[model samples]
Target: MKRVAILVETALASGRNILAGISQYIREHDDWSVFHPTGYMGATDIAGLVDWDGDGIIARISDPAILKNLKAKNTHIVDVLGNVQKSPFPLVKCDDRKIGRMVAEHFIGNGHRHFAFLGFSSERWSFERQEAFGQSLEKEHGQVSLCHLNPRHQGPAHWHRNLDHVASWVEGLPKPCAMLVASDQFGPLAMKACERSGISIPEEISIVGVDNDQSFCELCRPQLSSIEPNHTRVGYEAARLLDALITDERTSETLLETPPLSLYTRGSSDTMAVSDPALVKAMRFIRQEACNGISVDHVAESAGVSRSVLQRRFKDQLGRTVGDIILSVKLRRARDMLAFTKISIPEIAERSGFNYQEYLNYIFKKHLSTTPVRFREEAGR
Candidate 1:
């Protein structure tokens, strides 16, 4: 049996997912004994492992001392964390550029003209994501504001001061701007800043973040929307690479980048920034009632406009017809359910406002060019 030490934090959902993937790999392949010291926020000490004589190490190396200690073991190693400047071991992580472009596309599709990015100045991943997001927006003739918090700041006092600065910046932004935060932790902070400044979420401002931690996301007043990273894939790949390293099958510093699973839409970034009150009402109605089998007539009636007027106005402002918007919302929900849940196809169809599973399959193939089973399988991999 190979002895492995997992030096990853378990406080965050990402870490948990990674550990689960590693566990799955071990169960399928070989008898592996895993060791991890228990503590909060990855506060476990690496010094204790000096005499454990592990065969391999998988770690999110946050400190140089940990690297030094692990290197002394002369074992096969893989780094799962992407925040470090450089790593001698193989690295597996989410594609930060793809993440940024995905968020930009989602915001732009919702008709946002103004954009912003909130992240830590000291983190390499944050900078990469911010730069990619800004470039994507600029490509579409949109403007993006940038904000960075110094990583050196610590404690509640520094946090409050930073929150004040963020609130001031948010208050000064042009109305209805979309902001993508770096992580789940920072996303709620942005939302709190908006609340302090009296900004209406998804109305005056919209916010999205990386790492779709559902518990953390739902904790905010307007539940946060986030890019769900493929951490499980990251973990599985790390295990595969580490196994190869243990057997001397792989020796190079390989970097594995996985695309995100999907964007988990929520109340925080759910609306478009169109100025027409009727259009706003129609959109709100569609978002809330789309899964209930509501039609264009219902949307038109809710908006207090004729079907012709509603269709024309939707095309003029949102660039999509009434029927298309409803379908889009329903399809988005369907995709989310398929990716995140194990619900039956008939149940998924009912919840996604499709009349039947056959129709859902038809539309999925038409738009996505794949069956729902294949989509779910791809998501799992």
Candidate 2:
């Protein structure tokens, strides 16, 4: 059996999910033995592992010395980190460009015309996401503003010191703007800045962040919405690459990119940018109750409008009917479960408001052009 060393943290949910994927690959193949020295952030001490003589290594390399030491060992290695600086090892990471495009599409679908991106200046991934998001909005004839934290303002204290700057930038944006923050950590800070400036969320401004860290997302004043990256797929692909490398089946240093699962919608971005209060209420009700088997009539009643009036208004403002909106929400949820969970298709159908698995499959094929099983298989790979 090939012995592998995993040098990734277990503190963040993303990291844990990556480890889970690696474990899953090993379980399925039953040919690999894994070792992870865990403590204090779960970072492996390279010096301590120098003599371990592992056959292959999967690591999130943060320090230059880690690379130097691993190179000396001459073992097959795969990098789970997507650092801007190119490394000698193959990379497995989430597709940041696709993530940005997804965020832009989500905001545009909500009738938002003005957009903004909030990120750190020093992070390459953040810059990539910002650039892609801006390009997407531009293609749709929408405008995007940008705000990046200066590199000098790096840590918590410096970030707090720049709250006024963040507030100023946010306050100057056009009303009813949707903003995408780089990560969940930066999201709450932006929310705090907005709160301090008395900007109304999901009304005057809406915020979305990357990495759906549930605790952090839910802790914000309006509860932040976020893009949930498919880290499990990243890990699984990383393990597969490393296994191939160790077996001499692959030699190229390639980058494997996994698409994000879905956007985890929340209170922070629940409202559309349209001016109709009735339509807003209807959309909100549909999003919240769609998975409970609610119908277009229920949405109209909840919004205090007649079904015909709601249909006309929705078509005018959002370019879609109420039934379409409900189905979209259900389909999004179904896709998320299929990608991120091992739940059975029948259970997914029930949870996503479909009465039957066949019905779900039919709708998936009609709308997504792929069956649920095929989608899940592709995502897992």
Candidate 3:
């Protein structure tokens, strides 16, 4: 049996999912035995485990000195997180750049030109997303205002402690701004600050985040819209690449990219491109009831407008028909259910207000450019 060493950091769901996938693979494979030198080792302690002679090392950290030591021994390293630098070993990374572009597009589509980025202090992924965001916005000749929240300053105390500082930043920002956070952890804090400051979500301010940690997203009031990084797929791919390296079937310096993340647009990022109050309310009602067998008539009645009037207003305000909007919301909700729940496809279809799976498929392909299972797989990861 081949022995493998695991070194990782704590407090991030991405890291946890990677480790879970690796452990599951180890248990199912007979030829592999694991040696965990320590649980969730930090960057400074990696050198002590360097001489273990394990077949490979899988971790989410990317320190230059640590990589130097590991490479000196010809150890195989897989970068599950997007922090590694140029290395001889294979690397697997989430497409943080694409995620940034997608979220920026979503915000811009909703007619938000004033932008802000709630970023972590010193992470490579943070920088990558921030760069992609700026590049994407520049295409429209627009600018993104940025804010960096130092987690250390927030301290380990109640996250609420940071609300005052965060609120001050929001008050200074221009209205109708779209913000993207570094991760799910910081996204909620930002939302809390917004709530405390009387800044309404998807109205006064719309926010997006990376790493769709559902528990955290749902836990926030109004729910959070986030970009789901395919962490599990990254983990699986890294393990397979590490296996290939350990078996001597592949050489060093291999690089692999996971598929782009499929975004989950919830209440937080739900808004129209137009500034019409009636149309915005109609859009919100459609979003809220879309997964419950909603129809054009239902939406029209709920919005207290005639079907013809609703259709005209929707097309004029949202650049789409009422039917199109309903289908879009239903399809998106179906995707969310498919991703976070173990429900069957047919059941998901019914619950998401679609009468048939084929209808679901048609709409999903039309908007998201992917199938339901593929979306779920990417989101689950």
Clashing pairs in 1: none
**Poorly placed runs, candidate 1 (over 4 Å):** 152-159, 251-253, 275-315, 319-381
Q: Which ranges of candidate 3 are over 4 A from the true structure?
A: 37-53, 62-74, 82-89, 158-161, 274-315, 319-381
Estimate, for each residue in 1-381, the C-alpha lDDT of model 1 and write its tens digit.
Answer: 888888888877889888888988998897788888766566346765756787898888765777777778788889887666666777888888899999999998888888888998677778878988989989775668888898767447688988988998898888778999988878777988988997767766889988898778878866789999888888888988888888778456588888999998887887777767788678778877899989889999999999999999988887889888888878878887887689987899989999799999999999999988898899892
Off by over 4 Å in 2: 39-41, 44-48, 63-66, 150-159, 251-253, 275-381
lDDT of 2: 0.83
Q: Write the per-residue lDDT of candidate 2 for residues 154-182, one digit (tens) a residue.
A: 66678777787899999899877899998
Estimate the TM-score of every prediction.
0.75, 0.70, 0.72
Q: Least lDDT summed over 10 consecutive residues: which range in candidate 2?
A: 39-48
**Global fold similarity of model 3 (TM-score):** 0.72
lDDT of 2 at 79: 83
Clash pairs, model 2 backbone = none
Better of 1 and 3 by lDDT: 1
Better of 2 and 3 by lDDT: 2
| 106: Cα error in model 3, Å | 2.1
